[model samples]
Target: MPTWRPLTPNDITGLMQVANEIHPGLPERPEVFINRIALFPAGCLALEDEDGRLCGYAISHPIRRRCPPALDSVLVEISADADHYYVHDVAILPGLRGRGLAAECVARLLASDAAQGYSVAGLVSVYGTEAFWGRLGFRSVVVDEDLASKLREYGEDAVYLERVLDSQ
Candidate 1:
Protein backbone atom coordinates (compact mmCIF):
# COMPACT_ATOMS: atom_id res chain seq x y z
CA MET A 1 0.00 0.00 0.00
CA PRO A 2 1.12 3.57 -0.68
CA THR A 3 1.38 5.98 2.22
CA TRP A 4 1.74 9.73 2.42
CA ARG A 5 4.35 11.52 4.50
CA PRO A 6 5.93 14.93 4.96
CA LEU A 7 8.87 15.24 2.60
CA THR A 8 12.19 15.38 4.35
CA PRO A 9 15.80 15.89 3.26
CA ASN A 10 16.15 12.16 2.93
CA ASP A 11 13.19 11.95 0.57
CA ILE A 12 14.31 14.76 -1.70
CA THR A 13 16.37 12.57 -3.98
CA GLY A 14 13.66 10.02 -4.38
CA LEU A 15 11.03 12.63 -5.03
CA MET A 16 13.19 14.28 -7.69
CA GLN A 17 13.78 10.95 -9.32
CA VAL A 18 10.09 10.20 -9.50
CA ALA A 19 9.15 13.67 -10.69
CA ASN A 20 11.71 13.64 -13.48
CA GLU A 21 10.70 10.17 -14.54
CA ILE A 22 7.07 11.21 -14.80
CA HIS A 23 7.37 14.70 -16.26
CA PRO A 24 9.96 15.18 -18.95
CA GLY A 25 10.00 18.95 -19.40
CA LEU A 26 10.08 19.93 -15.74
CA PRO A 27 13.15 20.88 -13.77
CA GLU A 28 14.57 17.78 -12.11
CA ARG A 29 17.49 19.09 -10.13
CA PRO A 30 17.85 18.14 -6.51
CA GLU A 31 18.77 21.74 -5.71
CA VAL A 32 15.51 23.04 -7.17
CA PHE A 33 13.53 20.37 -5.34
CA ILE A 34 15.29 21.23 -2.12
CA ASN A 35 14.64 24.91 -2.63
CA ARG A 36 10.89 24.41 -3.12
CA ILE A 37 10.71 22.01 -0.20
CA ALA A 38 12.39 24.64 1.92
CA LEU A 39 10.02 27.32 0.67
CA PHE A 40 6.93 25.36 1.76
CA PRO A 41 7.95 22.54 4.02
CA ALA A 42 4.43 21.90 5.21
CA GLY A 43 3.01 22.14 1.69
CA CYS A 44 5.26 19.45 0.24
CA LEU A 45 4.06 15.88 0.50
CA ALA A 46 5.30 12.59 -0.86
CA LEU A 47 3.72 9.24 -1.60
CA GLU A 48 5.99 6.34 -0.82
CA ASP A 49 5.75 2.62 -1.30
CA GLU A 50 5.72 0.09 1.50
CA ASP A 51 9.48 0.09 1.64
CA GLY A 52 9.61 3.88 1.77
CA ARG A 53 10.55 4.56 -1.85
CA LEU A 54 8.98 7.69 -3.24
CA CYS A 55 6.35 7.27 -5.95
CA GLY A 56 4.98 10.79 -6.20
CA TYR A 57 5.35 14.30 -4.84
CA ALA A 58 3.51 17.64 -4.63
CA ILE A 59 4.90 21.14 -4.02
CA SER A 60 2.93 24.28 -3.17
CA HIS A 61 3.63 27.79 -1.98
CA PRO A 62 1.57 30.34 -0.04
CA ILE A 63 0.71 33.23 -2.32
CA ARG A 64 -0.71 36.38 -0.75
CA ARG A 65 -2.68 37.21 -3.88
CA ARG A 66 -6.33 38.25 -3.60
CA CYS A 67 -6.92 37.83 -7.33
CA PRO A 68 -5.59 34.82 -9.15
CA PRO A 69 -2.13 35.55 -10.56
CA ALA A 70 -1.74 35.54 -14.30
CA LEU A 71 -0.27 32.47 -15.96
CA ASP A 72 1.65 32.52 -19.21
CA SER A 73 3.39 29.23 -19.84
CA VAL A 74 4.71 28.60 -16.30
CA LEU A 75 6.00 32.08 -15.59
CA VAL A 76 4.05 32.80 -12.40
CA GLU A 77 4.76 36.03 -10.62
CA ILE A 78 2.91 37.24 -7.52
CA SER A 79 1.93 40.79 -6.80
CA ALA A 80 1.80 42.40 -3.37
CA ASP A 81 -1.99 42.09 -3.18
CA ALA A 82 -3.01 38.57 -4.23
CA ASP A 83 -3.48 36.06 -1.41
CA HIS A 84 -3.73 32.30 -1.92
CA TYR A 85 -1.79 29.08 -1.82
CA TYR A 86 -0.26 28.25 -5.19
CA VAL A 87 0.67 24.76 -6.21
CA HIS A 88 4.12 24.94 -7.78
CA ASP A 89 4.15 21.46 -9.19
CA VAL A 90 2.86 17.94 -8.72
CA ALA A 91 4.05 14.72 -10.29
CA ILE A 92 3.85 10.94 -10.03
CA LEU A 93 6.19 8.31 -11.32
CA PRO A 94 5.08 7.15 -14.74
CA GLY A 95 5.30 3.49 -13.78
CA LEU A 96 3.16 4.03 -10.69
CA ARG A 97 0.47 6.27 -12.16
CA GLY A 98 -3.25 5.36 -12.45
CA ARG A 99 -3.22 4.55 -8.73
CA GLY A 100 -4.47 7.96 -7.59
CA LEU A 101 -1.06 8.90 -6.28
CA ALA A 102 -1.10 12.28 -7.98
CA ALA A 103 -4.51 13.17 -6.58
CA GLU A 104 -3.56 11.93 -3.14
CA CYS A 105 -0.36 13.96 -3.18
CA VAL A 106 -2.29 17.11 -4.06
CA ALA A 107 -4.95 16.41 -1.43
CA ARG A 108 -2.31 15.93 1.21
CA LEU A 109 -0.71 19.24 0.33
CA LEU A 110 -4.04 21.08 0.42
CA ALA A 111 -4.99 19.50 3.73
CA SER A 112 -1.71 20.60 5.19
CA ASP A 113 -2.20 24.16 3.97
CA ALA A 114 -5.74 24.28 5.36
CA ALA A 115 -4.47 23.08 8.68
CA GLN A 116 -1.94 25.87 8.50
CA GLY A 117 -4.78 28.39 8.03
CA TYR A 118 -4.65 28.90 4.27
CA SER A 119 -8.01 28.93 2.42
CA VAL A 120 -7.14 28.92 -1.26
CA ALA A 121 -5.03 26.97 -3.78
CA GLY A 122 -3.82 27.88 -7.24
CA LEU A 123 -1.52 26.64 -10.02
CA VAL A 124 -0.54 27.08 -13.65
CA SER A 125 -1.38 24.08 -15.78
CA VAL A 126 0.22 23.25 -19.09
CA TYR A 127 0.90 20.34 -21.45
CA GLY A 128 -2.81 19.42 -21.46
CA THR A 129 -3.56 19.34 -17.74
CA GLU A 130 -6.37 21.92 -17.66
CA ALA A 131 -9.08 19.29 -17.49
CA PHE A 132 -7.24 17.31 -14.85
CA TRP A 133 -6.92 20.39 -12.66
CA GLY A 134 -10.58 21.19 -13.29
CA ARG A 135 -11.56 17.78 -12.02
CA LEU A 136 -9.66 18.66 -8.89
CA GLY A 137 -11.77 21.81 -8.40
CA PHE A 138 -9.60 24.34 -10.21
CA ARG A 139 -11.25 26.92 -12.45
CA SER A 140 -9.75 28.78 -15.35
CA VAL A 141 -8.81 32.39 -14.66
CA VAL A 142 -8.09 35.00 -17.29
CA VAL A 143 -4.52 36.22 -17.48
CA ASP A 144 -4.09 39.93 -17.94
CA GLU A 145 -1.35 41.79 -19.78
CA ASP A 146 0.39 43.03 -16.64
CA LEU A 147 0.89 39.50 -15.32
CA ALA A 148 1.44 38.17 -18.79
CA SER A 149 4.30 40.57 -19.35
CA LYS A 150 6.01 39.40 -16.20
CA LEU A 151 5.66 35.77 -17.26
CA ARG A 152 6.73 36.45 -20.83
CA GLU A 153 10.16 34.97 -20.10
CA TYR A 154 8.57 31.54 -19.70
CA GLY A 155 7.03 31.78 -23.15
CA GLU A 156 3.32 32.39 -23.88
CA ASP A 157 1.51 29.10 -23.41
CA ALA A 158 1.07 28.13 -19.77
CA VAL A 159 -2.51 28.15 -18.44
CA TYR A 160 -3.56 29.41 -14.99
CA LEU A 161 -6.00 27.56 -12.72
CA GLU A 162 -7.30 28.25 -9.22
CA ARG A 163 -9.26 26.41 -6.49
CA VAL A 164 -10.79 28.19 -3.54
CA LEU A 165 -10.94 26.26 -0.30
CA ASP A 166 -14.19 26.37 1.64
CA SER A 167 -13.89 27.59 5.18
CA GLN A 168 -15.31 24.54 6.81
Candidate 2:
Protein backbone atom coordinates (compact mmCIF):
# COMPACT_ATOMS: atom_id res chain seq x y z
CA MET A 1 0.00 0.00 0.00
CA PRO A 2 1.04 3.58 -0.60
CA THR A 3 0.61 6.49 1.80
CA TRP A 4 0.74 10.24 1.44
CA ARG A 5 3.48 12.05 3.35
CA PRO A 6 4.86 15.53 3.56
CA LEU A 7 7.27 16.19 0.71
CA THR A 8 10.72 17.27 1.80
CA PRO A 9 13.74 18.66 -0.03
CA ASN A 10 15.36 15.27 0.30
CA ASP A 11 12.72 13.78 -1.97
CA ILE A 12 13.48 16.02 -4.96
CA THR A 13 15.57 13.44 -6.80
CA GLY A 14 12.88 10.77 -6.70
CA LEU A 15 10.18 13.37 -7.21
CA MET A 16 11.86 14.59 -10.40
CA GLN A 17 12.15 11.06 -11.66
CA VAL A 18 8.43 10.47 -11.12
CA ALA A 19 7.60 13.80 -12.71
CA ASN A 20 9.77 13.11 -15.73
CA GLU A 21 8.16 9.76 -16.34
CA ILE A 22 4.61 10.99 -15.75
CA HIS A 23 4.78 14.42 -17.37
CA PRO A 24 7.45 14.22 -20.02
CA GLY A 25 6.02 17.07 -22.07
CA LEU A 26 4.93 19.25 -19.17
CA PRO A 27 8.26 19.29 -17.37
CA GLU A 28 8.86 21.43 -14.31
CA ARG A 29 12.21 21.95 -12.63
CA PRO A 30 13.00 20.97 -9.05
CA GLU A 31 13.00 24.62 -8.05
CA VAL A 32 9.27 24.68 -8.53
CA PHE A 33 8.85 21.88 -6.04
CA ILE A 34 11.29 23.47 -3.66
CA ASN A 35 9.45 26.74 -3.90
CA ARG A 36 6.04 25.21 -3.39
CA ILE A 37 7.20 23.20 -0.39
CA ALA A 38 8.80 26.28 1.07
CA LEU A 39 5.77 28.46 0.47
CA PHE A 40 3.11 26.04 1.68
CA PRO A 41 4.49 22.81 3.06
CA ALA A 42 1.01 21.68 3.97
CA GLY A 43 0.04 21.47 0.31
CA CYS A 44 3.05 19.43 -0.79
CA LEU A 45 2.52 15.69 -0.75
CA ALA A 46 4.49 12.64 -1.79
CA LEU A 47 3.01 9.19 -2.10
CA GLU A 48 5.35 6.40 -1.11
CA ASP A 49 4.94 2.66 -1.29
CA GLU A 50 5.64 0.30 1.57
CA ASP A 51 9.13 -0.06 0.18
CA GLY A 52 9.53 3.69 0.63
CA ARG A 53 9.73 4.47 -3.06
CA LEU A 54 8.04 7.50 -4.51
CA CYS A 55 5.06 6.62 -6.66
CA GLY A 56 3.17 9.89 -6.99
CA TYR A 57 3.01 13.53 -5.97
CA ALA A 58 0.47 16.34 -5.64
CA ILE A 59 0.92 20.07 -5.29
CA SER A 60 -1.79 22.51 -4.29
CA HIS A 61 -1.86 26.08 -3.10
CA PRO A 62 -4.23 28.94 -2.67
CA ILE A 63 -4.45 31.00 -5.84
CA ARG A 64 -6.72 33.68 -7.15
CA ARG A 65 -9.64 32.49 -9.26
CA ARG A 66 -9.37 33.06 -13.04
CA CYS A 67 -5.59 33.25 -12.67
CA PRO A 68 -3.44 30.14 -12.65
CA PRO A 69 0.30 29.94 -12.66
CA ALA A 70 2.06 29.21 -15.92
CA LEU A 71 3.36 25.73 -16.58
CA ASP A 72 7.03 25.17 -15.60
CA SER A 73 7.12 28.54 -13.90
CA VAL A 74 7.84 29.12 -10.20
CA LEU A 75 5.42 31.16 -8.15
CA VAL A 76 7.74 33.64 -6.46
CA GLU A 77 5.14 34.01 -3.76
CA ILE A 78 1.64 32.88 -2.94
CA SER A 79 -1.10 35.40 -3.59
CA ALA A 80 -1.82 37.78 -0.74
CA ASP A 81 -5.56 37.46 -1.31
CA ALA A 82 -5.90 34.10 -2.97
CA ASP A 83 -9.52 33.00 -2.88
CA HIS A 84 -9.41 29.44 -4.21
CA TYR A 85 -7.33 26.38 -3.55
CA TYR A 86 -5.60 25.39 -6.77
CA VAL A 87 -4.55 21.85 -7.55
CA HIS A 88 -1.36 22.80 -9.27
CA ASP A 89 -0.50 19.29 -10.34
CA VAL A 90 -1.09 15.65 -9.50
CA ALA A 91 0.76 12.79 -11.18
CA ILE A 92 0.73 9.09 -10.46
CA LEU A 93 2.58 6.17 -11.96
CA PRO A 94 0.64 4.23 -14.57
CA GLY A 95 0.55 1.25 -12.21
CA LEU A 96 -1.26 3.31 -9.58
CA ARG A 97 -4.18 4.52 -11.68
CA GLY A 98 -7.75 3.41 -10.82
CA ARG A 99 -6.86 2.98 -7.16
CA GLY A 100 -8.55 6.25 -6.11
CA LEU A 101 -5.18 7.76 -5.23
CA ALA A 102 -5.93 10.90 -7.19
CA ALA A 103 -9.26 11.44 -5.53
CA GLU A 104 -7.80 10.73 -2.10
CA CYS A 105 -5.09 13.26 -2.76
CA VAL A 106 -7.55 15.98 -3.66
CA ALA A 107 -9.82 15.11 -0.76
CA ARG A 108 -6.98 15.31 1.71
CA LEU A 109 -5.81 18.57 0.16
CA LEU A 110 -9.22 20.17 0.37
CA ALA A 111 -9.45 19.16 4.01
CA SER A 112 -5.95 20.43 4.77
CA ASP A 113 -5.16 23.44 6.88
CA ALA A 114 -3.86 25.26 3.83
CA ALA A 115 -7.24 24.92 2.17
CA GLN A 116 -9.26 26.35 5.03
CA GLY A 117 -9.54 29.85 3.60
CA TYR A 118 -10.73 28.65 0.22
CA SER A 119 -14.30 28.13 -0.85
CA VAL A 120 -13.48 26.42 -4.13
CA ALA A 121 -10.81 24.44 -5.92
CA GLY A 122 -9.51 25.07 -9.42
CA LEU A 123 -7.36 23.27 -11.95
CA VAL A 124 -6.34 23.36 -15.60
CA SER A 125 -7.29 20.02 -17.07
CA VAL A 126 -5.11 18.69 -19.85
CA TYR A 127 -4.22 15.55 -21.80
CA GLY A 128 -7.90 14.82 -22.44
CA THR A 129 -8.51 14.44 -18.72
CA GLU A 130 -11.51 16.74 -18.65
CA ALA A 131 -13.80 13.79 -18.08
CA PHE A 132 -11.67 12.58 -15.19
CA TRP A 133 -11.80 16.00 -13.57
CA GLY A 134 -15.51 16.21 -14.21
CA ARG A 135 -15.93 12.98 -12.29
CA LEU A 136 -14.02 14.54 -9.43
CA GLY A 137 -16.64 17.31 -9.08
CA PHE A 138 -14.90 19.80 -11.32
CA ARG A 139 -16.77 21.31 -14.25
CA SER A 140 -15.38 23.27 -17.14
CA VAL A 141 -16.02 26.96 -16.84
CA VAL A 142 -15.44 29.55 -19.51
CA VAL A 143 -12.79 32.07 -18.64
CA ASP A 144 -12.09 35.57 -19.78
CA GLU A 145 -9.65 36.43 -22.57
CA ASP A 146 -6.67 36.72 -20.26
CA LEU A 147 -7.43 33.51 -18.39
CA ALA A 148 -8.15 31.59 -21.56
CA SER A 149 -4.79 32.79 -22.81
CA LYS A 150 -3.08 31.39 -19.72
CA LEU A 151 -4.83 28.05 -20.12
CA ARG A 152 -3.29 27.87 -23.57
CA GLU A 153 0.11 27.63 -21.90
CA TYR A 154 -0.84 24.16 -20.67
CA GLY A 155 -2.11 22.95 -24.03
CA GLU A 156 -4.75 23.72 -26.62
CA ASP A 157 -6.95 21.00 -25.16
CA ALA A 158 -6.54 22.47 -21.72
CA VAL A 159 -9.78 23.50 -20.05
CA TYR A 160 -10.17 25.49 -16.88
CA LEU A 161 -12.24 23.65 -14.28
CA GLU A 162 -13.55 24.58 -10.85
CA ARG A 163 -15.36 22.79 -8.02
CA VAL A 164 -17.07 24.46 -5.14
CA LEU A 165 -15.85 23.10 -1.82
CA ASP A 166 -18.53 21.41 0.31
CA SER A 167 -17.22 22.93 3.54
CA GLN A 168 -15.79 20.06 5.44
Candidate No. with top TM-score: 2
Any runs in candidate 2 off by more than 4 Å, and if so which?
Answer: none
Give the local distance difference test score of model 1.
0.67
Tell me the whole-model lDDT of each prediction, alpha carbons only. 0.67, 0.90
Lowest summed-lDDT stretch of 10 residues in model 1? Answer: 66-75
| Tens digit of per-residue lDDT, candidate 2, span 1-168 | 899999888999989999999888888999999999999899999999989999999998988887888887888899998998999989899999999999999889988888996889999898999999989999999799999888888878999999999874
Q: Which residue pairs clash within candidate 1?
A: 64-82, 64-83, 65-82, 65-83, 66-82, 66-83, 73-158
TM-score of each candidate structure, all chains considered together: 0.77, 0.96
Task: State each candidate's clash count.
Answer: 7, 0
Per-residue C-alpha lDDT of model 1 across residues 80-138, encoded as one tens digit per residue = 45467888777776677677777877776776633355567777776678888898899
Best by lDDT: 2
